[model samples]
Target: MFFLGCFATATAAAAAAEVAAPVPGYVLDNTEVREIHAASLKRDYQLYVALPDSYRASERRYPVVFVVDAGYAFPVARGIASRLHRHAGMEEAIVVGLSYAKGDEGVYSRRRDYTPSVPRNGGYRSDMPGRPAAFGEADAYGRFIATEVFPHVAAHYRADMRRKIFVGHSYGSLLGLQVLLTRPNTFEHYILGSPSLWFDRGVMFDREKAYAAAHGDMPASVFFGIGSRETLAPGKQRSRAEEDADMVADLRDFHGALAAHRYRGLATTLKVFADEDHASVFPLVLTHGLRAYLKQK
Candidate 1:
C-alpha cells in the first residue's frame, strides 16, 4: 500500500511539471522580427514586419502601415491587412508592429511614449501594463520613429514614402495626433481609433489652436472612429453626463474643430461604431479604417 501511494504521488508531480513547462514560440507566416536601436528614445525597439504575399514576386513599392502597441496588435493588424487585400479589394501594404524591448522594467514606456501632455495632477490611468506617472514624451517618440524607424524601413524594404499610414488606438491615437499636428508630412494618412482626447482636460484642442495659428494650411488625410457605447456609463456608475471620461463627446468636439478649421489640403472622416465599447472597437477600426484610408485616390 505504501509503495502504491508513493508511485501515484510521483506520477502526479511529473504530470504537473510537464503541464507547467513553457511552450515553444510559434512564428507567424509572412512575418519577421527586427530589433532597432533608437538613439533619441535611448532604447531598443522590436519591429514586427508583415510583408504582403506578392512582395517577393513584384518590383513594385508598397504602402506601409505602422501599428502602435504592436505587442498586442501586431498579429491582428497583419491578419486584417492580409484579409482586406485578398477579399475586400483594398490595396496591399506592409504592416509594421512597434514593440518595446523584452522584459522591460515597469512596462510604462507606452504611456510615456504615447502621451502628449502629462495630467495636471501628476497622475493618469493607462491601459498598458504599469501604473502611470508624469509622462509626456510623444515628441521624442516621434523623432525616433521618423529618424530611426522610417530610415531603416525605407533602406531595407521597398516602402513608398509618400503613401505611409499610421494606425493607433486610445493613447496610441493621441500620439498619432501629436505627430499629425507637429510633423504633418511624416505620414500621408492617419487612422486614429478611440483617441483619449479627454486626457489632460482636452490639451489636444489647445494643440490644434497652436497649429492653426502657426501654419496657414495642413496637408494630410485623417480618419477617426469611436465606439457608440463609449459614452455609456460603466457598470453601476453614473451616466456620461456626470463622468469625466466621456469619449464620445470628446471625439465629436475634436472632429468638429477639425471640420471648422477647414485647413487647406486636409481630408478628414469620422465614424462611430454602433454597439461597441472602447476595447471592442479596435478590430472594426482595423478593418474598415484601413479601407477608408488606403483606398486608391
Candidate 2:
C-alpha cells in the first residue's frame, strides 16, 4: 500500500511538471516566414524562405528557386533540396515558397493568381467545383513576382538574380507557363509538374500562338513531367468534357509545340512516370527534375 502510494505520487508530480512545462513546437532548419505585400494587387503574401546549409559559411551568391503553392510544396521542396544537395551531388539553391494572399483561402487566391485567363463560353473547371466563378489574373500576378518578389529577394539575400528557377505543379504550372510565355527572362529554369493545361478553354494555346508570332526564341531551360494515369484508362470512353481534360495529352502536345517552334536556346525535357497518377507523381517530378537540371556538372 505504501509503495503504491509513493509511485502514484511520483507519477502525478511528473505529469504535473510536464503539463506546466513549455511545449516545443516543430521548426524547420534555416527557414523563415517573411511577409511581403504586393503593391499592385493590394495583397500580402507569406514567403517560406529556406536557406542552404552552406549559406552562412560561404560568401557565394546562390541560385534561387521560386516554388508556388507554398502551403504544401515549400516543406517538401526544402527537404528534397537538402537531400539532393547532401547525397545526390546537386547544387544547393535558396528555396523560396510563394504563399497565397495572406487573408484569403488558398483556393480563392490560386484561382485568381495562378490562372492565365478566365474561362470562355461556359467552360467549367470540374476539378474545382464551387471555386470562385470568375478569376484569372496571372498577368498581374506575374508583375507582383517580378516587381515585388524578385527585387525583394535581390535586395535582401545573396541570391543570383540571373539564375532564377521556378517550380510549380497543376494550376501553379499555369502561372509558370504564363511567365515562361510572356516573360521568359523572369526565370532561367522552369520545372513544371503535371500542369493543368485544360484550364480556361485552352486559352494558353492562344497565348503561345501570340508569343511565337512576336518572338524568335524563348531563352530558357524547361522540364515537363506528368503521370501516365492522368489520362483515361484503356478503352474507357469519357465525355467530351472529360476527354478534353486529358492532362497527359495536353502536356505532350504543348511540349511538341514548343519543340516544333525550334526556339533558339530553348532546352526542354519531358518525362512520363509509369503507374503514377496526377497526385502520386508530383514528388517524382520534383526529384527527377531538380536532379536533371540542377545536378552538379
Candidate 3:
C-alpha cells in the first residue's frame, strides 16, 4: 500500500535500490510511474508501469492493460509480461498497476469505489440506507477512468487505445462488468478473476441476460476465472457458508450466460483452479489470460 513511485523521476531511485545482481535469466527494471488524486473518488491512486526491453528501441506504440488492485498483483503481471516478451517476442504492452491510498483506508476506499450498486435484500448488502450510500458512486468512478485516467495515460505515454485491456479481481470485477455493459467498447479485452458476481443478488447476471436478448453481436474478448477452492465449510466454525456458495453459484451462472450469447465477435473462456483460493489464483489467471489475449491478437 506504499507509494510504488511518486514522480517519474523516482523510477531511477527505485532501480538503484535493487543494485544487487539479477537472478539468472530474469531481469528487473522500473518503468514510468504516476500518482493522481482522482477527484471523483477523492483519493490518491498510484500507477506502476513496466515496459519490455524492446520498448526502448521501438518507436511503435503498444497496447495497454490496466490491472486493478495493482498493489499486490503488479508483481505477478510484471512477471507475465517479461516472460512473454523474452520467450515468444509477444507484442509489448504498457502494464499499469492501479493502487489506491495506503493502509486500511485503501481497503474501504476500493470497496466504495469499485462496487456498482448495493442490493436491497442480499447477504452482502450494506446496512447503510439507499443504494448510493452503501455502493458509493460507480457511475462517477467509471466516468473518472474513462475521462481522466485513460486520457492521462494515453497522452503521456505511447499507448494504443484501440487495444485497451482491463484486468480486475473481486469488486474490481464488478467494475469491469459495469463498464462492459454500459460502455461495451471501453475495453477491447477483459480479464476478470474471481469477480464478486454475487453482489446485489446477482444483478450483473440479470443485466447480461437483458443485453444478450437485445443485442446482436458484442465485440469484445473476455477471460473469466475462479478458484476451485471458492467455497466455505458449512458449520459453526465458518462465518457464512451459504453466502460463499451463493457467490460461486452466481459466478458460474454469469459465465454460462455469456457463453449462451455465443456472440460471434466475442471470444470468452472460463477456468477454475483446483489448488487456488480466492486470493491465490490471481497470478495463474493473469498468466493464462494474457497468453490467450496474445494468441487472439
Best by lDDT: 2
Which one wins by lDDT: 1 or 3? 1
Alpha-carbon deviation at 192 in model 3, angstroms: 0.5
- Model 1 — which ten-residue stretch has the worst lDDT? 235-244
lDDT of 1 at 78: 93
Q: Which has the greatest TM-score? A: 2
Q: Which pairs of residues collide in model 3?
A: none
Query: What's the distance in Å from true for residue 125, model 1?
Result: 8.3
For model 2 the TM-score comes to: 0.88
Per-residue alpha-carbon lDDT of candidate 2 for residues 165-208, written as tens digits (9 for 90 to 100): 89999999999999999999889999999888777667887788
How many clashes in candidate 1?
0
Q: TM-score: which is higher, 1 or 2?
A: 2
In angstroms, the error of model 2 at 290 is: 1.5
Per-model CA lDDT versus the true structure: 0.85, 0.87, 0.75
Please provide, for model 1 over 1-297, each residue's C-alpha lDDT reduced to its tens digit, 9 standing for 90 to 100: 999999999999999999999999888988888889988767888899999999999999999999999988889999999888888778899999999645454347777888897766554455455644537888889889999999999998989878889999998998999998999888888989999887776789899999988887779889898899988466644222224567887888889988888899889888999999988999888787788777643
* Residue 104 in candidate 3, Cα distance off native in Å: 7.4
lDDT of 1 at 282: 93
- Kindly report which residue stretches of model 1 are placed more than 4 angstroms away from their true locations once superposed: 1-22, 101-107, 124-134, 232-243
State each model's C-alpha RMSD to the native: 4.3, 3.4, 10.2
Which candidate order results from sorting by lDDT in descending order? 2, 1, 3
